[model samples]
Target: MAFHAHPDDEALATGGTLARLAAEGHRVVIVVATDGVVRDAPGAALRARLDELRASAAVLGASRVEHLGYADSGHGAELYPDPPGRTRFVRADPREATARLAEIIRAEQASILLSYDVNGGYRHRDHLRVHEVGRLAAQQTGVRLLEATLPRELTVRAYTALEWTGLVSGHNRQALQHGFTPRAEITHRLDVRGYARQKRDALAAHGSQLRKGRVAPLVRLLIRLPAPVFGLALGREYFIEPGAARTGKPSRQIIPPAGQG
Candidate 1:
């Protein structure tokens, strides 16, 4: 089960990995913590976004897609008020959220639970809350834990270059201050280059966000690239498992054998 903070996060972060696993006959599932509803997009727009999410999941070959039933926690210098009738993920009770997520983990009998790293990739409050809640859910369910993250050195170098190239905005660059996990700290670096098509298709399925400008410009550029170029850019996904020693090289896969943890 892969747990994400929002709709497109699964695709942007681990879509290729999920596609590969699903294609290998593994039952892949995606669980998101929020509706990705930061603003008051028309009700129809929100419904369409959900539909798009399901479409994306189908493209990735996921067996199930579940939402934890929370609202988005807006990001940026100015905090936006939560939409009426919904609680932002950052404001939700962590214990309650974890309990609900634990139920899903138990129900799925999932061996692995994917969440976000300590820094939540860019210190997004909702993503950080996801990290905390996901940890608790793993502890409660005894599922193996894997947190999604990028290699710190890679992120810094690549983004710095992108900034220099004028591809990244100052605001987005500033958000990277919290940092990603160093290469030595990453436990898995699954290569999903072969399933890039599935990843790309899944990413495109979230058309509303792509059209509405919900994702970062970098992501938009990636999705718009030719298939081969897109694969080359995001062929691998990185992860860290708490308490696990870093291997000399990244593991090709995340799941252990049926009898293993």
Candidate 2:
């Protein structure tokens, strides 16, 4: 199960991984935590975007798509005063959200659960709530794999070095400026280079939110980067497994390139 805050998030963050898993015959499900109404897109426009999401899921080979029916909590200042009749995700009861997600996990019999990091990858309030609900649902369901982004020490080091050398530019700088957490704590890195094209196509399917002119080139560039470079130094997806037995020492679940098998 891939838990995302909104429609486009699954494409942005886990498209590659999800596509690869589905291609390998793994049953994959996407749980969208919100309706993504923050952008002020018309009701019909949002529904169209969701239909696009479903189409993208098909391209990604997802077996199912689940909507938690939560509302998008607009970014930062926009969240204040709770927009008229719109549902506010930040103020939604976490317990209720967790219960909803937990039910989905049970229904799907999800062995693995993937979600954004605690920082929401960019500190979006809805993203943070997804993280919290994911953690709680994982605990409740005893899912064997809980995939999430963690702050990666090496990524931080690389960013710092780049900043010192004045090489950080474009989107990298924008990421820094916006306080996005791109360097996550990686635990498992699946080599998605084989499915990179499918991932790109899946991303493209989110037409309403991802305008082709704006994101296509960047997606192309990202797909072209060597797989090793793509995962940064971690070169593996990361996760924190709940209820796993601890041996009084950290486990070496972090997959190196040679260990991707």
Candidate 3:
């Protein structure tokens, strides 16, 4: 099971891994914490985005997709008002969210729970909340937790270069510099170059988000890259599993052997 802060996050962070696992005949499930709606988008727009998410999940071969029934918590200094009765993911009670996720983990009998690192990738409020809730859920269900992250140094360098091009916002570049797990802390690096096409398709599915200016340019550029270039650039996904036994090389697969745990 992969738990993410928003609809597109699964695609951006772990889509390749998910697709590879699914193609290998493992049941893959995606659990998103928010509806990805901000600024009180029209009901039709919200529904359309959800539909796109479902399509993305299907293309990635996910067996199931679930939303944790929370609204998107917008970024930057000002917080957007919640849509009607819906609560922003960042404001929702952590315990409640943990319980909700734990129930799903138990039901799926999931052996692994993929979540965000301590800094929650780029430190979006919802992403940080995902880390908090995900850790609790993993503990509650006794599932092995793998925190999805990139090498902080690498991310900082990439963001710095992009920032110079005016592609990354000042706030976002700063966030990226501080987010992601340190290289020494990363325990796994899955080579997912083989699944680049699926990852691209999954990313393309989040049409609504790709239309938004804040993150659209980068997403569009990635999606438009040549398949080989995209694979070379985003082929490996980094992860950290605290207290996990590392007897051998970093795992290329998400799950460990059944008896090893």
Candidate 4:
């Protein structure tokens, strides 16, 4: 099971890895914490994003997808309050959120919980909440944990590429440089190049999310790239296991058995 902050986040962070695992016959599940509803947005938008999430999950070969019943914490210095009856994900109690996610982990008997690193891949509040909740949920359920993240240098390189296209300004680039894990901290670096098509298709399913953010252009550019180029740019996915050795090169697969995880 892969737990993320929002609908499209799974596609960006775990689409390739999930696709590869699903193709290999493992049952992959995508769990999101929020409905992607921002400030003053109509509540109906959540329904649309859920539909898109389902579409994206299908493209990645995921067997199931679910939301934890919360709304997005919009991107700004100040966080808005709950929308009607919905709780903003960032404002939701961590213990309650952890319990909710833990219930799913238990129900799924999830062997491994794929979560985000401590920095939540760019310091988004909702993403940080996801990391916090995911960690505690995994601990509560006794599931093996793998935190998804990019190497610091690769993250900077990606930001630089976006800066070149004017999608991410220097301020944004500097902020992103502080996210992701360092290379030495990485444990699993799966070569998902083979699943590029599935990954791209999954990413394309989040059209609504990809159409308006400052990083939208960067995402759109990725989707427009040729298959080979896309693979070269994002061929590998990285993760850090709680106690996995970082002695040699990172492991090629999530687990030793081809389909165990």
Candidate 5:
């Protein structure tokens, strides 16, 4: 099971692993925590993107796709500027969201649950909330949790690459001012090079979000890199597996549990 704050998130974060897992005959379901309709676009444009999400999910080979029906709290803006809104996920009760996620976990009998890291990777408020709710759901339901993270070394390399390529600008620097960490702490790497095409196809599905921009080309390049080169470049998909027995205090050595295969 994969839990994400929005539609494109799954493709960006775990499309490769999800595709690989489904190809290997494992049941992979995607639970989108929010509707992702809060982009800088018109209502019709958002609707089109929502449709694209479904198409992308099919291409990614998800066994099922479930939506928690929460509204996307536009990034960098409070969901409610005046009074609170019921649709805004960030404002929704945490326990309520967690229970909803727990129900999905129970229904699917998911042995492995994938979600974003504690920092929400780039600190999007909804993403962070999804991380919180996802953790609560996994804990309550006793499902194995996998937090998506970037290895520390790989993150540094990516940042370096962006800087060298002149892609990391003042805006990115300002965003990182909050703080950043090594991606390797999560510990599991899924090489998605083989599924890169599918991942790219999935990304392209989110047309509203993928407006003509510099980021699109960068994303395309990142996913299109050859598997070996990409692996050497990005290393692996970092993960933190919950409920695994530890020989020592929690460190970055965690691996997916045996049965998850």
Candidate 6:
């Protein structure tokens, strides 16, 4: 199962891996911690985001999809007020959140849970919460945990390329500097080049993010790239095991063999 902060996150961070796994006959489940709604933000509706997430998940071949029932805290300072009855994910009780996720882990019988790195890949409040809740829930359920991330240097290079094409207009150049895990710390680097087209399709499914500046120009540029260029740039996915076993050159599988474990 892959657990993420938002709708497009699965497509951007682990889409290829999820697609590859499902194509390989493994049951892939996509779960999000938030509905990714901010009432004041343009084109950011809860139902729209959830629909987009389901569409994206379908493209990635996820057999099932779920939300943990929380509101998007959004990025930057000044958290928005929670919608009607829901609480902002960042303000929810950790133990309660952990329990909710733990229940899913048990129900799914997942062998491993994929989530964000310790810094939540950019320190977004909701992503940070996902990292924490995922780790705790996986532990509670006796499942392995793989924290999805990019080598800090890779993110920097990506931002630079995006900047050159003006695709990252108004985006911070140094945003990738601090939050990602380092290359040396990454335990798995799965090559998903063969599934690049599917990955691209999955990303394209989240049309709201692409239309609104919510995700901005970076994704816009990505979907526009030719197949080969997109594959070369984003065909590989990264992850860290966080104290889990490591043996025999970081196996390519997201869920390593039982012997390896």
Give RMSD to native, each candidate: 2.1, 5.6, 2.2, 1.5, 4.0, 2.7
Winning candidate number (lDDT): 3
Sorted on lDDT, highest at the top, how do the candidates line up?
3, 4, 6, 1, 5, 2
Instruction: Report the C-alpha lDDT of model 3 over 42-144, residue by residue, as the tens digit.
Output: 7887778778889999989999999989999987677888888789987889999999999999999997899999998988899999999989998788899
On a 0 to 100 scale, what is the lDDT of residue 235 in model 4?
A: 83
Ranking by TM-score: 4, 3, 1, 6, 5, 2
Check candidate 1 and list the clashing pairs.
none
Q: What are the lDDT figures for the candidates, one per model?
A: 0.84, 0.66, 0.87, 0.86, 0.71, 0.85
Runs off by more than 4 Å, candidate 5: 39-43, 77-86, 164-168, 174-184, 212-214, 220-235, 243-261
Candidate 2: global Cα-lDDT? 0.66
Write the number of the candidate with greater lDDT, choosing between 3 and 4.
3
TM-score to native of every candidate shown: 0.93, 0.73, 0.94, 0.95, 0.80, 0.91
Q: What is the C-alpha lDDT profile of model 6 across 1-261, one tens digit per residue?
A: 999988889999999999888887778999898888755534437778889899888888898999999888988678878777788899999889889888888998998799899989978889999999998898788888999998898788877776677666436656678878988788898999999998998999988888786456778878988867889989999999999566656657676433444
Q: List the residue pairs that clash in candidate 6.
A: none
Model 2: CA > 4 A from native: 80-86, 150-185, 212-261
**Better-scoring candidate (lDDT), 1 or 4:** 4
Tens-place lDDT per residue, model 2, 77-179, is 6564444455567788888888988898898887688876656665677887887888888778887555455444544555666556444534444444344
- Candidate 3 ranges beyond 4 A from true positions: 245-249, 256-261
Clashes of each: 0, 11, 0, 0, 8, 0
Per-residue lDDT tens digits for candidate 4, residues 1-261, read: 999988888887888899888888788999999998786577567688899999999999899998999889977888887888889998889999999999989999989999999898888988888889988998899999999999998888877876676777888667677898888899999988888888887888888868787778778888998877898988889999877778888887886545353
Q: In angstroms, what RMSD does candidate 5 have relative to the true structure?
A: 4.0
Residue 214 displacement (Å), model 1: 7.0
